[model samples]
Every structure is written in structure tokens, then in C-alpha cells.
Target chain A: MENNRGNKYSIRQRILSSKLTFTILSIIMGLLVGAIVLLIAGFNPVQAYRIMIDGVFSRTKYISYAIIYATPLIITGLSVTFAFRTGLFNIGAEGQYIIGALVATLIGYFLELPLVIHVIVVFLFAAIAAGLWGGIAGFLKAKFGVHEVIATIMLNWIALYLNNYLVMRPFLRRPESESSYDILDSASITILEKWKYSETGREWLSAHPYIKDFLSAPANLGFIIAILLAILVWYILNRTTLGYELRAVGFNKDAAEYGGIKVEKSIITSMMIAGALAGSAGALQVMGVTKNVIMLPVMEGYGFDGIAVALIGGTTAIGNIFSGLLFGALQYGGPKIQPPLGAPSEVVDIMIGTIVLFIAIPKLFKIIMNARKRGEKNAK
Target chain B: MLNDIGFIIGTSLMYAAPLLFTALGGVISENSGVVNIGLEGMMTIGAFIGAAVGYYVGNPWIAFIAAGLAGGIFALLHAIASVTFHADQVVSGIAINFLGPGVALFISRLLFNGSTMTKSLSFSAKMPRPLNGLFRSNSFSDIIFNQYATVYLAFILVFVMWYTLYKTKLGLRIRAVGEHPASADTLGVSVTKIRYFGVILSGILAGFGGAAMSIAVVSNFRPTLISGQGFIALAAVIFGKWKPQGAMWACLLFGAAQGLTVYLGGAGVINISSQLLAMLPYVLTLVVLVGFVGKSVAPAASGEAYEKGE
Candidate 1:
């Protein structure tokens, strides 16, 4: 009996001490702040939240759509997560994403290969373009001592204008519209109907005729690719020597250098990899979702969104998958709930911002824990 | 030909004024060893408040005060998160950036019945122009002298920032804290107070900059009023090598890029796509960073959290 009691108490103690507690607390705090905002806006917070939750999970199609939405975020989250693990802030993810999309679009437009080969080629093109784009900042940091933040921020604007310029004129220009022409059908990812139904020769659809919504959803190979990459990242970070060196560089660059690691090389490699992840996000976005490059009136800002995902995920591969799903659900579900609540979907942005802000200040949680500990001691 | 050059110069000055204020704000905060990436957020809030208040109160001066106060208050959140809690400054700044637009748009929707822009106020306030008498005779002189009040104020602030950083006892303490806070603490100067002042002053200046966008340049505040000028200001701080005078020059160079874009694109003198023209300032920022060889040095303690007696 005493052992059972002690076990329960220790589990509670572990919960209090674990970093997950703060992560959950920050999320709750963010929700409560969001609730207050909703209240001020004259909506019932509980109902609104329920609507949001229900909107994301009401049907299998909703769930599939959520996954589709999560696909790009997961990649971008991993991009930021990978960079964080290497002790570098790659704020150029947006630029990298753009460059990747541009490269992927070019390859998709010009090339006419078999379906699988075309996809692989597009991915490779995106990764290399974005990798080089990200490496530019790393090179500047390594060679010229330029701060990555300044360099990346500049790159983002340049990429934005470049994307706009490319979309508007001689490169991928549509005569009547600002957006580019859709890529060849061979370059596009197969839809769910083709993936599942075609494989089973109509047997799968006969068994699940009610799943029309599921068949219509844009979920593609990209979602599976994102999941595989996440798991691969976890394995690499835990098992690989390269990952070990990267983490060592992140933990302490001078010490890593003393330990015979090539600090500059690691920085460049990590940034390049990070950029590839973000670029893949762009490639997936174009090939699987948008189908073409639409001229952006303003920045799409998926890169900044990646920052929130990474921070919420605790900058870990495993955490990224979960948090990426949450952010993705919020994003996909936000608009669905908007009409009912008469609230602009931007409340989700507020929630995300608030969560990140709370998570950033881990000291607040620590202070509260210390105060609680002192209170218990006095009682004892 | 000279008249056209003078016109471009005048437009450049007008465009540079807001950027000048924001860059000055960035310099102050960074010099105090705090990395403020939330200039965009602060400017957004300032633009909204300045326009909203100016419309409601019918006084641009009072609106300016409200705008500055709103920015300072928003910055306090950053100070508390970064200074008191010792959170990562970049994360805090990003939070500020996200929260600013969300909150601004929300409030804008509430007050304006779903419109993102505030109602235009009839009374527009500008800076005191002292050079009007000197340039009254010629068109070139008119182009130079005909400007909003903020243009002159921004130029004067260049001198003011330079004087404050180099001449005063407070400036000495600010520089000391930025360079080496631990050493400054040993000399009995409070690093916390200096940093707070630096950050708050930055908020105020950036607020004025945003206000200049809505009240002086444009008639009202829209969600996109400040756009990416705060970021341009940030680049200016880097391009200027973190010096007041240098930032002023950098702002002018960037402003000229913008001025050229507008003038050439509007006049159809530049045959290239407007998108390419729009790309000039951003591309120049990259060129300036890469091409400049002096190796700009940041404050030694910048981006580090200082704890007393640690």
C-alpha cells in the first residue's frame, strides 16, 4: 500500500518537474488568453473552442484535410527544428521555401519524365536550390561575420521580390492572369482516389462508399513523406555521428571546435539541410496542393509560421510532428468556425503568438515551482 | 534636369524620414545590448493607434502621444519577457510581432465595424519647417523645402542621436552597459534601468515613425501602412554599422532607392518591370551587407541575458 502511494506521488512529482508540464501549461495559458479575446469580442469562448475542435474532427475528410494542411508545416517545423539543434537561427526559411518552389516549378514545367522519376527530380531540384540559398547566409556568417538574422531577413525580402518579378513577367508568365501556368499532369502527385481506389481495383471504394469526402481530399504522398522525414530526423539526431556533431556544435561551438569538429562546416551543412527541409515544403506545396505558383500580393509567411511550430514543438523532431498537427488543425479549422462565431480567424494567430511567448519564458514556470516548493516546506 | 534631381531628392527625404526614426530606435535598443526584432510590431501598433486616436479626438498631437504610449506599453511586454524572465530575446520579439498585427486588426475590426483602415481625420499635423524661407525663390529650392515636419525632425534627430551617444553622461552609461554590462554593474551603474530606458525610448521613436506613415505621409492607417519599413529600418541599422550618423546615411540611401522606384516607375522612364524596380532596395540591402568591408560590430553583450550576481 505504501509503495503504491509512493509510486503515485513520484509520478506526480515527475509531472511537476518535467518540461512537458511547462509546454502544456503554456498551451493552456495561451488558450485562456484566447478565450479572453473571444469574450471581449462577444463570443462564448467554450462554444467557439468546441466549434474549432469539432470542425477539425467532425469527419474523416476533415482529418485528412488537417493532415494535408499539416504537411507543409511539418516540413517547415522540421526545418526550424533542425536549425535550432545546430545553434543557428535560419530566418531565411521563407526565402528558402520560395526559392525551392521556384526551382520545383521550373523543373516541373520543363521536364517530362515518368511520374515517380519526375517527383524525385523535382524534390532534388528544390533541395539543392534552397540548400544553396540557405548556405549563402551560412557562408556570409562563416566568412564575413554577418549576423544570420540580418542576412536571412534581407534574403527573405529579396526572395519575395524575386518571386513576384518571376511570376509577373518572362518567367512563367500567364498572359491574362498574374499566376503561372499549371505544371504538367505527370509532375503532379496522385490524389487519394488514384492512390487507394486504383490500387485495389474499386474494391476499396466498394467497401467504403460513404467516404466520398475522403476520396476528394487533397491528401497525397507528401503527408507520408513528411511523417517519414520526421521519424528519420529523430533517428538521425539520436543515432548518427553527424547529428551528434551538430548537437555538440549547438551546445557549445568553442568546445566542439576544441573537440576537433569543423564548426564552420557543421554550420553550413546544418543550414543547408534546414533550407532543404523548408524548400521541400515549398515543393510539396506546389506539386501537391497549389498546383501552380500564384503571384503573392504579400508574403505567404509560412516561414514565420514555422518558427511558431518549432518553438511549440520544443524544437524536437517528435515534438514537431505533434505540434505541427495542432497548428495545422488550428489553421485548417479556423476558417470553418469563423462564420459561426463572427470572429476573424486571426484569433488562432493570437493563440499561437501567446503560446510561443509563454513557452519562451520558462523562468515563469520555474519561479512558480520554486514558490510552490517553499510553500510546501513551510507547511511541513 | 536639375529640377528632376531635386524632386527625387525631396521625395527621398520624405521616404527616409520614417525609416530614419525606426532605425534610430533600433540603434538605441541594440546599443543597450537588447536585440529588438519587434520594431515591426511596435510600428504596426503605433500606426493604428495614431490614426484611430487622431480620428476620434480630432487632434493629431494628442494622437501622437497615444501612439507613443501604446508602443511603449507594448514594449514593456518585451522588456518583461526578455529582461525580467530572461527569455530568448528573438522569441519575445517574434511574439510581439505576431501579437501586434493580430491585436491591431482585431481592434480595428471592432472599432471600424470590420474595416481594417481607420477613418481619415480632417486635421493633419506635420513637423515645423524652418527652411521654408531659405528656399522660397526657385523650383529646385521649393522641391527641397516643401516637406512634412517629420522630414526636418528626422534630420535633427540624426544630430540629436549622435550628440546623445557621444556627449552626455547617460550616453556613457548606455555605451558602457552595451559593451560590458557586468563591468558597468561593477561600477555601480544599473544595467537593468539603462536597458529598460533604451528599449522604451526605441518604442517611442518607432511609434513616431509609424505615426509619420499614417498622419504625415498617408491620410489614415491601414493594416499594410507600415508594411516592411520596420525591417528596412533594421537593415539600415546594420548598413550603418550601428552608428547614429551611419544609420542616417543608410536610411537616405535606401530612401533614394525607394524614391527612384516610385519616380521612375510612375514616370515610365524606367522600362523595366515595376517588380524589378521594387526589388532594388531589398537587393541593395544585401549588396551593402556583403560589399561593405568594415565588418560591422554589434554591442558585445547584445542578445545575452544578464543576471545580477551571476
Candidate 2:
């Protein structure tokens, strides 16, 4: 069924094939696997899929909320993808996320500035803080020759405890409250009551009444920024010289070095950008959703999740968007799976783990390729 | 202050115990060329199985053996995946990490009700009050000396492992295989067999380490409690330069850092936020790892899977 004769292709198409096919396949594969998982759990796969679809596309509010949920994942996923593209594994996204949020939280709490400036300051400071946090691993890797994987994992612990310490110390939250001081209305993304309801369908089942009152992905305008950033990332990767050098380094360090690329510099820069992306995610989450940085009990574990996102996305920019959305859906749908079947929230995590396992098993793809080759030969 | 110093050292020593076992586990596996990233999970599993067996069988010794056996079995899975099937060592290690927690969570859930957390034993699972009225008039001796049996075992394991690795023939082959499997293969050593033994030994050590946490330190099993100690074990593995004695010191030092965090958190000794103090051990790993990256060479082929035919 393959057309060998129509082999002529432009340079753009080759790049597109490497990026697009994987993105499409990952999205489709994640969904299909997710569906199978749901089916095995005794839920109708179709119904579960419909619930997720309805959750996202069923209303304007849902879509906004879905976009909101996707905000940090998109940002964090991009952060991860950026590093992967540069051949660095920044598994400390969680740490960077926390440090970013902590910076923003500290800023948002003390500052009484006007809304726009307040949000901008919070996000910027957070990004800088997180970038520096990630830069440590990069710095260590470059200077000391330590593996980023080991160092970043260590960093995750430091972040977890560091955030916990913040929650307990100077930022010691009130006894009844487990969070930081709430930000002023300027920093918060309170959904406008006017836009709360579904514009298309005002009916009871058509719109969720709780959608207006509930928490969001990244509450504020950060989701919009994250989406716009993805487009920019696409441009950078496909249209910039820096992107080419970074990618060449990622594809083969020896070859890239031979090709006159400063591989080490590229790695450090990539890690900084990756950290910045994750930090932005933290900023968005703190400003948009939480309004202030509320120290949670544990590090959000999003960075660890981001690894899976980057991997399944083939570590590409645009591909990360779809794969991230897929991951986001699984994460969002995870809570929905509870209560009915009495499964723990960790079941979703277990499934995510399994999906990572399935993905890592490259033999499945090898077998598929072999079968296709055999078919082609038999046809000949 | 003397009591505090004594307390800190004592708790640090106590914390060092599990970490020592874990690092030894790291040493065992890495010495054979497999990096056991699942040590934390393996430890968790060990804790559960140890607790369950110890609790039911009424014999803590049985718990230790059962835990080691269970850990050996888990190692077998890694052995097959990495050695025979030729999976990426990191990938397989990660898979075991994922699988261990899930299986533990699932099986724990099946056995317990009302909470996802495993129920605490009727008594401390493996911890026994030391001194046994040897100094009924002395609170100091009881408080300082009394701790779990596992804690003592972990310390003993440090020397045991060092002796086992450096002063033994089997350890030589294990080290040789880990360093250069191809060269070792030509020397007529069963490269695969040694690697399998190395990884399995690691699982057992890690399993015992996990048991220590559940039994000696926490006295219970819970999600997120191990809190990346597996990596700490890894750091100890590196910080010790992959040597048992050095790793034990690192583990004790890191463990003390942990004990200090808790002590200071409890006493408010440092104005440093408890969260910041909590970050100490992990942050310190970086500080430690950076202290000697190139100087401390790993087993030459630590993360690389050894393929026989290749």
C-alpha cells in the first residue's frame, strides 16, 4: 500500500514527517490505550471517552476550564520538551515549578501593586527563580560532570522540603489554613460571572453549574500565554539557527561537536530555557489558579509527569501540545474515575506508569515494522 | 547540648542504618553493572512483606528472611528484563520503581480498609526496646541504646558488605563483570550470571533498607513517605564512590541531616524554614555529588546493559 514512486519531497516535509507523524501517533495511541484501560476497569470505554470529550468540548466554560487545566501542563511540557530537544533531561521540573511558585507567592503576598503589574511581577520573578534552580543542575553537569538525571532527582527532594519549610516558617500559614496569604483580586483569575455559563446551551445538562465555582488548570491569563509560547517554540525550533544547533547537539553530541557546535553551552542554555518554561508553569498556576502560592504537602510531581509527556510527545514542541493534552486528559479524568468504582487516585498514576512501560517497550514498534517489511516483500 | 549532640549522633546513626543497607544494595547491583533505581520501591515492598510476615508469623527474623527472599524475587525480574531481554537498564529500573509502588499500593489496599494507608501493626513491626531493664534506673541508657533490631543489622551490613565485596573471590568476578563485561566474558566468567547476582543482591539490600524505614523509622507504611531516599541511596552510592564503607558514611551523614531536619523542625533550632531544612538532604546530594564527579569513578559500565553475543 506504500507509494515508493512518489518519493520527491521538500525539506519542510521531511521535518514535518519526523514531528507530525509522532505527534499524531502519540495522541491517537494515548487515547486508544486510555480507552482500553478504562474498559478493563469496568467502565465503558466509549462512555468514559465521551465524558472526557464532553468535559472539554461540551461547553464554553468547559473549554475555558480545559484550557485552564492545560496551561501548566503545556508550559511544563514545553519546558520538558525544550530540554529533551537539547539532549538534557531536566527531571527537576517539579523543583523548578515549586521554586517558581514560591517566588511568585512571596511577591504576590507582600505586594499591593495594581493587578497587571502585580501578575507580571509575580510571573517574572517566578520564572527567574525557577530558571536559576534548574541552572544548578546544568551548571553542575557542565562544570563537574554529574549526570542531570541524578542531580535533578536530588533537586526534586530539595524542592519538596524547601516548599514545605516555606509553608511552615516565615510564610507559616494559619493553623486552619494550609496555604499562603491569598492574593488581591488583581492577581486572581476570578471567572467573570457574565462568562460563567455556556453561551451556546443554557440548559441544565448542557452546562455544569459547578464549573463557575470550581478551581482551574492555571487560573489566570497564563493559559493564553502558554499556548502563544508553544507557537513561538514552533517557530524557534523550525525557523531559528539556535534551535538547529540545540537539536543537532541533542541528536548526536559527538557529531554536533564535530560540526563545530558548542555542545556544552547548548546544553546549559537548553536547561535554562527548560527551567524557564517550567517556572512559567509554576507562575501561571500560582497567579491564575491558586491566586497565591499555597504550599501543598508534596511537590506537585508534575515534573516527573512531564518526563512521560516529553517522551510520549517525541520531545518536539508542537507534539508536546497534543501529547500534553493527552496526559492532561488522563490526569483530569483520573479524579473522575474515583468514587464510582472505589479506585484510588493512584490508579490513574499506576495506569500512567503502565503507559510509560508500554511506550518504553520499543519491540512492539519493531515488530510492526518487521511485519510491514515482510508484507512488502511478499507482495513483490 | 551534650544530650542534643548525643541525640543527633544517635538518630543520625539510626538513619544511617537504612541508608547503609540501601547504598550497599546500590554497590552490589552497580558492581555488577545494573543500576537499581527501584531501590526505594523495593524497600517499600520489603517493608510491607516484612511487616506482614513478621506480624503474622510472630517472628521478626522470619520477616528479615522473607523480605530478603521477596527482594531477591524482585531482582530476578530486573535480571530477566535487563540481562536476558536486553531492556534499557534505566527504563527497566524505572519500570520496577513504578511497578513496586503500584503493586504495594494495590495489595495493601486489598488487605486494608477505610484508608489507602497500610494499618500500623499491633506492635512496632521489627523494632524492639533495647536494654531490657539492664538499667531500669537509667533513662539515658534506655533512650540512647534502645532502638529497632533492624537499625543494628543495617550497620553490621556495612562491614559485612565491604568484606563481601572487596575481600572475596565472587566479589572480584562481580567487579570485573561490571567494569568490562566483554573482557570478563573472555576470562570464562558467566557475565550474565554475575550481573544477575549483582542486581539480585542489590534488590535484597534495598528490600532490607525499605523494611528498616517501615519497621524502624516510621513504624508504618504510607505513600510519599520514602520521599526519594532511593535516590539518596543512589547519591550515597556515588558519594561513597561506589564503595561500601564510604557509602555507609555518606548514608549516615545524609541520615543525620535528615535527623537534624526533624530535630530542628521539632525544636526550632534554626530559623531556616522547616521546608528548607527538609530540602537539606536532597540539596546536599548535589553538593556532595558535585564535590567529586570525575574523581569518583562509577563501575565503568554502570547503567549499560550487558549483551552476551554483542
Candidate 3:
């Protein structure tokens, strides 16, 4: 029998076909599995989901609040997507977000300028700082072929320290509070319309008829940036030469090289873009949600959640938005799930993790079996 | 001032000691072909179970042994899933890491009257003063000799790992399996068994590392208290270039960096933002990674499971 070694269908088609199928299947699979777990735990699986939906979208107000909640995640999700498209797993989004937030927050607090320039410079400063942070990892990988996973993870720890420093050191509160100085009001991204907050925020809770008092969320403008960036990222990834090179490299390095793409430059650029998105997300959170840049427990785990979002979305920015919305909803309404058996918000995390675990299986097993079969053939 | 240098080395070793043990374990596991990303989880479980057993049993030595066994079982889960079932190592490892604290916290709440942390049980596990006295002067002896026994074990493990990796046939098979497990299977090496051993060995060391934390360093276990130390050990492994001795040095450097962070941070000596100063070691780890970027290559099949045939 002839060996089909390496002559399998091209990655391009497999991606177009299999990835879509895998993604849909995984989502369904995750939901089903989670329902089963819920059922076994003696909870009404269907009701739990209803409550979940209710938590995120029982009213127009709720949905608005959910989007506000999803803003930073969408930003970070786009960040991860940008790098994934280029075959670089920029796991350091958390770090970049921290650095970006700290840098921009310092500018927000210390420097006085015209509101427009102040906002523009702060945002740009954040994006640039995060880009440089991620670029360092990219630079190392490009120059030395370091595994980006290891590099990015380490960077995350560094970010934790740097962020901690900003809150405690330069940006430390006048009274040593675990916060920075409130950004100048001119630079602060305030809610322009108080009525919208009444409609979409915790203020609306007073009007909630049944159990409304229990639900309150900070409805902010970061969600707008999240959605806009998601759309923008979709365009960049699907309709650009840069995106072509990136996907090409991710598909097959040798083939991408053959196609005349500069693999190294693409990786570095992709990482930079990933960092920028995360940084922007960080900046927006300070600008939109909180008036001041508080210490990390603010951005906590959102960056990591971006990985799950990208995976759940199968790495497409559009798909990420849907998944991001779904994730945002889960997070938004999670703590509100009524208990006897509501399970902590971690249940959603476990569910998300289980889905990714399922997806990682086929890829891992295929390579193992292929090598074994080759070994068996060689032995014979 | 001169004694401060010895004191720093002594203290750094004490701090790096746990990392060295864990990094050594990582070398064996990765070299033998299991990714063992669950080191963090394994270490945590070790800390939890060992501390629990120690608190209940009132014997620190038993806790030490129990920690190794506990660490091994957690790792065995990783081995069964990834080594036998051919699951993704990273994902599986993450599962274990997440499961570690979650399950431990759940049990701790139920058993310990809802106080998540075990009661304090501080007792020095340092080596005898006599051992250090013979090698160095009285001052050095007091610094090094009075350290935990784990320090000696870590030092011994480094040399032993080098010997096993180079001199022993089992080590050779382990290395071969990691690089090309399929070939090893053809030669009747039982890639699964080798991988299992590799992972379990990592667990044992990691467990001991955890035991070091509980018995020697903190002498108490808090929920999530290890706080990413296993990852630091992982970084140490990369810095050490996947070799036991190199990893030990890496651990020492990281430990010293951290020690200085604490020492200076405590004294308020470094006027930099305590936050920035605190972040220095983590940032240093990132810088160290750049040096490791291209220099270190993992075993070819480190994270890949071995299947018999299509």
C-alpha cells in the first residue's frame, strides 16, 4: 500500500471546513456536557440556562449591561486573535494589558492637556507600550526561535509585578490606597447621558420588577470600542495582505516561505497588533469603566479568558464577538444565578475549559498515531 | 559585609531549594517525554495533602513521604490521560492545575471547620549543623548546615540526575522515548511505561518541593499559597537548559532575586516603588527567557502522546 504521508488535504481547506465544523460541534458539545453535569448535580439544566439567559438578556437594560461587561474581553479576544492569525500565540495579553493600563493611567493622572489630545496621547501611549512589551517576545522568537508560549507566560508574571508597582509606587494613591490618582476629569471617559445609565445600568434596578434589586452592573462605553475593534479586526484578518501572510505562516511555515512571505516579520507584527488590542482594552477600561486605574484585581483573568474566547470562536474575530458576547453574558449573569445548585461562576470556566480540552484532543491524538503507524511500518 | 555574601548564598539556596527539586523533576519528566504541565497542580496537591496529613498525624517526616506519594498520584492522572490516552499535555495539565485548588478548597472547607488553610506547623527541616561545619567555617556552617534536609537532597539530586541521564541505560531509554517514542516502542521499550515513569518522577520531585514549602520554608499551607512557584521552577528549568545542574543554578538565581525582593522590600531600603521592586523578579524571569529563547530545544515528542498504530 502506498503511504499518504504529508500529501493529506491542504491546511487551507481543512481550516475552512473542519474548523467551522469543529467549532459548532464543540459549542454544542460544551453546552450538552455542561447540562449533563448540571442535571447530575440535581439542578434543572434547562432552567439554569434560562436563568443564564435571563441574567444576561432578560431586558434591554440587561443586554446593554452585558455588552458593557464584555468590552475589555472583546478587546483582549481580538488581541489574541491578531496574534493567532500570525502563528504566534501571544499569551502575554494579560501582561500587555497591565503595562498599557499603567502607562496610560499615569498619563491620565499626571499630565494635563486638552481633553482630545490627552485622550489620544494616553491611548496611543498605551498601545505603543503594550506593542513594545509584546514585541520583545516577538523579537526573541524571531531572532532565536524561542517558544512564544513560554516567553509570553513569563511576560505575564512580569506584567503582574509592573502593574503592582504602578499602583504601589509612582501612581500610588496619596494615602497609599491600592489605587492610582483619579484621572483628571477632562481625560475621564464619563457617561455623557445619565438616562442611558438609568436604563442600562444598576440605576435601572430600582425599576426592575422581580428580583431587580439583586442585579446591578456597571454599564460603560468600553463595549463600543470592543465591538468596533472586533469588526475592524475581522476586516484586517480576512481582507489584507498582512493577514494572508500570517495565515499562510500558521498553515505551513515552509509553504509560507515558498510563497515569499517574511515569516519572522509577520510574527513580530502580529504580536505587536495583539498587544495593541489588549493595551487598548486596558486603556478603555480605565477610561470607560473606572475613573482611576486600580491595581490588577481590575483586569484579572480577562486576558486569560480571551484564549477561551478565541478557541471557542475558532480564532475568527467575528466568531469571537459572538463567543465574546456569549462569554460576556456568562460572566455578566454568572454570579446572579440563583442557587440551591446555581454553582459558582467557575462552572462556566470549567465548561469553557472542557470545550477547549475536547478541541485539543484530535490534534494531539492525530500526531501521535501518525508517528506510531510510521514506526510500525518501519519495523515490519 | 563579607558574611553577608555567604548569608545571601545560603539564603538563596534555601529559597531556591524547592525550585531546584521541582526543576529536576521537570527535567526527568520532559526528558522522558511527558510535558508534565501539571507541576503546579502536583506541587499544590503535595502541599495540601502533606500539610493535611502532617497536621493530623503530627509527624513532619511522614508528611514529607506522603507529599511525594500525593504528588505522584496527581501526576499519575496526567500520565493516564496523556500518556495512555494520548491527550494534549498542556490542556490536561491545565485541568489538573485548576482541579488542584478547586478540589482541595472544597475538601478543606468540609473537613477543617471552613478554615481553608491548615493550622500552622512550623518546624525546621534544615540539615544538621555538623555537615556544614566540616565543609566551611562556623559562620558558613550556621548558614548552610542549619538549612532543611531538602537542601541536601536537592544538591544530591542534581548530581544523581546528571549521572542517570548520561550513565544509566534507563536514562538513555528515557531520552530516546522523549525524542522519538515510536522508535522506542519498536524496540520494546514500552513508551507508555517510560513516559509514566517520567511523569511520576516529576510528581515525586514536585511533591518534595511542596513538602519543602510546608515543612521547611513556610511550615504552613495556605490555599493557593505556593502562588505560581511551580511555574517559577519551570522557568528555572528553561534557564538551566533542561539540565539538572543548570536548573539548580536557575532556581538559585530566581530564589536570590526573590529573596532580595523580600529583604529589601522588608527593610524599605530600595526606595523604588515596592510594586516595581516586587515585579523585578518576574520581569527578570522574562528577561531570562529571552536568553533561553532559541538556545533550549525541547524533546521532540515532549508534549505528544505515543499511540501504537493507526
Query: Which is the leading candidate under DockQ?
Result: 1
Candidate 1 lDDT, A257-370, residue by residue in tens: 999999998888888888998999999888898777877766687888888888888888988888889999989987665677677677787888898889889899989988
DockQ of 3: 0.37
When candidate 2 is compared with the true two-chain complex, its DockQ is: 0.39
Please list the residue runs of candidate 1 whose C-alpha ends up more than 4 Å from where it truly belongs after superposition. Answer: A1-11, A193-210, B123-138, B294-296
Candidate 3, B1-310: lDDT as tens digits? 5555566667777788888888898999989988766787778878877777787777777888888998898788778778776776766776566545544544454447555687777453322233544554547557655676778888898999999998999989999999998888889898988889989989989988888887677767776567677877876776677778888887887788767666666566556665566566666765666655356478888877777883
lDDT of 2 by residue, B1-310 (tens): 6667667766777787777787899899998888777686677677777666666665667777777777777777777777765666655665566556665665565556524466665564456656556754435555556667777788778888888888998878989988999999999999888988888888998878877776667656777666567777877887788888888888887888878876886788777666666666676677777777366488998878776678
Q: Write the per-residue lDDT of candidate 2 for residues A148-259, one digit (tens) a residue.
A: 8777878777776667667656544646666777656666544442243457434543356655434222335675687787887777777899999989998998999999
Q: Per-residue CA lDDT of candidate 3, range A1-380, in tens? A: 14445658666546644666666665676678667755765567787788888877767667767776677778888888888877777768888888778888788888899967888888899889999888888887887776677677778877887676667665356465777877775565545434444656545645664434223345555776677888889888889888777888888988998889988887788788889889888888887667566665323766777876776677789878888887788777765654534344445654665566555455544455568869999999
Ranking by TM-score: 1, 2, 3
The local distance difference test score of each candidate is 0.83, 0.72, 0.74
Query: TM-score, chain A, per candidate?
Result: 0.92, 0.80, 0.80
Q: Score the docking of each candidate (DockQ).
A: 0.63, 0.39, 0.37
Model 2 residue runs over 4 Å out of place are A1-3, A6-70, A112-117, A169-176, A189-220, A234-238, A251-259, A364-380, B52-58, B65-77, B129-144, B268-276, B279-285, B308-310
> What stretches of model 3 exceed 4 Å from their correct place?
A1-69, A112-121, A170-172, A189-216, A295-299, A322-353, A363-380, B113-116, B122-140, B269-296, B307-310
lDDT of 2 at A311: 64
Arranged by DockQ, best first = 1, 2, 3
Comparing 1 with 2 on lDDT, the higher-scoring candidate is 1
Cα TM-score of candidate 1 = 0.93
